[model samples]
Target: MYKTSTKIHLYTVRSQMRPALLLSMTLFSLLMLSSCKKGSPGSVNDPGTEPQPVADAAFLQVSTSELNTMAIDNKNVLWFAGDNRGAVSGLGNKNKNVSFVRVADQVKSVSVSDSRSMIIKSDNSVWTSGDNGFGELGIGNAVSNGNFVKVADEAEQIEAGWENGFIIKPDHSLWASGFNHYQIFNSSYSLADVVDTYQKIADNVQAISVGQAHVLMLKTDGSLWVCGQNVNGQLGTGNNTEQRGFVKIMDGVKAIEACSYHSLIIKTDNSLWATGHNEYGELGIGNNTDQNRFVKVMDNVSALAGGRFFSMAIKNDGTLWASGYNNQTFGITGPDQNKFIKVADNVTAVAASEYHSMMIKSDKTLWATGSNTYGEIGAGSERSLSVFTKVKLK
Candidate 1:
């Protein structure tokens, strides 16, 4: 009876061991099936999903060569200017320079359609390169460049001076580079300073302009602010004292532009105001005597552009007016008169170079005048033009 009991116990243990082994193998098979499903072709492991588009993808659409300046229109199309050329195109990822459609090639200065983008290069230094040779790059150093380098980020607009760079940040703050000979950087302005005062304005700025040494800022609320080299009375403060910090210039200002040594402001009433270095009568105050206060140029002015030592404006009726240095050497010779005089009609847009000028008509046709030594006026010659001549872009 004892032997029989032992044999039965051994058989029971063997039976239990077999069932446990089967259970382990079943679990292992299930785990392997699950892993295979996870990596299967019809499962979530597929790798064919399209990439999401970038949020500001519109900026990546257009292809511009040696883009020295850029502006976005009301339709979001991008207009860009090169070192001596310009182009307009719909925003996209196309890389064809042929589709860029050149506007001007010998350009040294450029401003945007909505008055938001400005680019300038003078004295063989690209202001946007942050090359500070003679303090021209505005980064407080004199570095050279083999190609264009973006010196700042989040810049909504930019303007260039003889050796300085000015820009409006996306946050409506102002920034300046180049020379600070007159404390344009405010009280802390210095040749070694790199911090831009727009970060200290304590308010949001709508627009800003930089003259030879002076700076102008228009606030969102229609208030005007001025700072830096005021010796020429460009600050419009009614005093000759140089402003080392931001001061109110005036109110009701809609737009502002700065030339070589002067400033132009447009009021909400459509009147134009100007001040500073008028040795050439650039202020259009009817005289060459310098004025420390803002003086009216004309009423019903719609748009204004300033050159190195001259200025131009368009009236609401589409007539164009120009003032300041119009000498044959400077390239402005439309009318024999030097003071603010009417030039042409049906003008749509105007751009000013160091000593040259360009205009686009209502028909999308372009015209230019002044110094064409480098074919900057696109008149097919190096001759200095004195009148508005049509430019063929075909």
Candidate 2:
């Protein structure tokens, strides 16, 4: 048996700059117990004694939108910040030189879109905040909200896209609302009539990823399905055709990610594969040619993420590798990276948006790079950064 004990502390820091930039921070202290290793039944210590839980590791995980960032610490406290123009509320500010402030409380997880945010609280209820243009907030109407509003109950996971919101129920079923552009909801509903409430799509879903106009989901049996726009073959259906409903594209998939016009998958064998727009070699296939079918990129990938025109992966050794547009958008200088290039080591988790990227180290410290327009990079300045910089937290 496995168990977890966690402690969460909220940290809010505001930039010294006028009209302060908000940064949300969560300090997670976790205690975890590993499952018992294989051993002879009568060779181990007395069965009467319970195994003690271990404090081996803890780290942060982050997700980003076009304008905001959200993070879940080891204790499941979700912290949020960015685009304060009525984009998100429940924020606490600090008068300091820091560039981040903590917001929200008792959150278990979070996800963001271009202008909206969603979080699952400890009670298993889901809440939404920010832009609802097209009903992305999943609040049962096409109304925008600046403050967090309860949208659903008994949610297990949540995600937001360009203007769409998605939630997974306790039954491993998928649900969504918001913009119907490219038929993201797998319905013939016109763009003029967007989904207002969380509508059911499919069941037995193990994971779901939302892109600008496309969406991907993984079934409990390791099957991959995709729907929506395929202008650049982002659906990986071996063709450039739009899909209104879920279509099986691959199997044995362990993880998946999507953004803008591309899709990525990590198989059970720890191999990385990609499909869709490669205008800037975001596929990391050693060329800028687009692919309609999934193509192998590398192996030994442990975790993966994709930006608008770039993708990032972490190896089993804790090293970070990236490919695709290498311009300022990639947080690197010089020519574009057609093949995976080692950028950093000891990275535990990563989150990528259209123009900026944020990562967490094994030590639980956060780092960011790429476009800093509006200080979304959490570097305390509007100037873009081409190299990773540690975000100072209070």
Candidate 3:
């Protein structure tokens, strides 16, 4: 629980003190009051002193990670509900109110798709849980693991897709193992490859983002590479051709993210770009037309997240924005927002799942809005929240 008090307690002394001492005390009190920032309770400026600001009852410092179906907190705790299962057994076994459970301690990073979940441990080793029907676990078998199982070592990052898993090595090379039904593995080679273990895919890969059946990779030279199902022009290669291997799409890219059928990117100029299926206007280009090539959407984007048919972004000034399919029954607001619209201010991080969204503000507090049929809102109830609400992690 959080307190809503803004009153400051002051003390008065009966005996007169020296002019110098009284003046110093007054200055200290003023400093303490001025240092209080929103979301952070208690002043550290004058610790162990009288009339100190009350410490926050809920003191959890948080950063949120939404895996398109699951969410994690700064403490490596996992929150899940709805159709997705496995990965951290019993985390949401009941299927009612959202269950509060931590996956593992010291988790360096995590990733998930519609059915699979992956995590990189503190040892620089990779572990995976959930559906593995296509050898998505990269553990030399097609069997699934309800509990996390180690698959690789010295991994810097991990990403999961509908039927594939990807990892980045300490040397910056890329490795992948799983179902390549859409030629997401070897673009120029045959699609008959069935990887049972980690197989070298590419080199000089800096980052990766995978969606339903497609993927986007950022090369060390700031060039963007893409592959997989392009039925909706998700590859953004000017045609609806499914790539055999990664094809260079653009240059001067900084970050990229994808959802079920669309992709978003942030370029070096701090501008936002989008391409692919736009049935729900997920591209945020002021229309619902599918884009075969990248189109400029907004400017000054610092970070972003893409969901099933919607997108969320954080501007350089800490304002949160959302676009794409929205209606009175679900989504951010309006029947739909073809253009970006402000949602909140002072947001430091933002994440989007299939049908919901979450964000952390500068105050280190967590807030959520959108779909909550399975209690994904972290409010410990099944009631769907159409407006932002404080997630009670405590």
Model number with the top lDDT = 2
| TM-scores for candidates 1 onward, in order | 0.63, 0.80, 0.77
For candidate 3, give the lDDT of residue 291. 91
lDDT (Cα atoms) of all candidates against the true structure: 0.57, 0.76, 0.71
> Residue-pair clashes per candidate, as listed?
17, 5, 2
Q: Give the Å shift of residue 55 in candidate 3.
A: 11
lDDT of 1 at 57: 14
Clash count, predicted structure 2 = 5
lDDT of 2 by residue, 162-271 (tens): 67788889999988887676665555576567887888878999999988888899999999999888989999998898887688987899999987899999999999
Expressed as tens digits, the lDDT of each residue in 160-225 for candidate 3 is 766778999989899988876666666554677667677888999989988767899999899999
Distance from true location, Cα of 174 in model 2, Å:
0.6
The model with the greater lDDT, 1 or 3, is 3
What residue pairs are clashing in model 2?
12-102, 13-100, 13-101, 23-100, 23-101
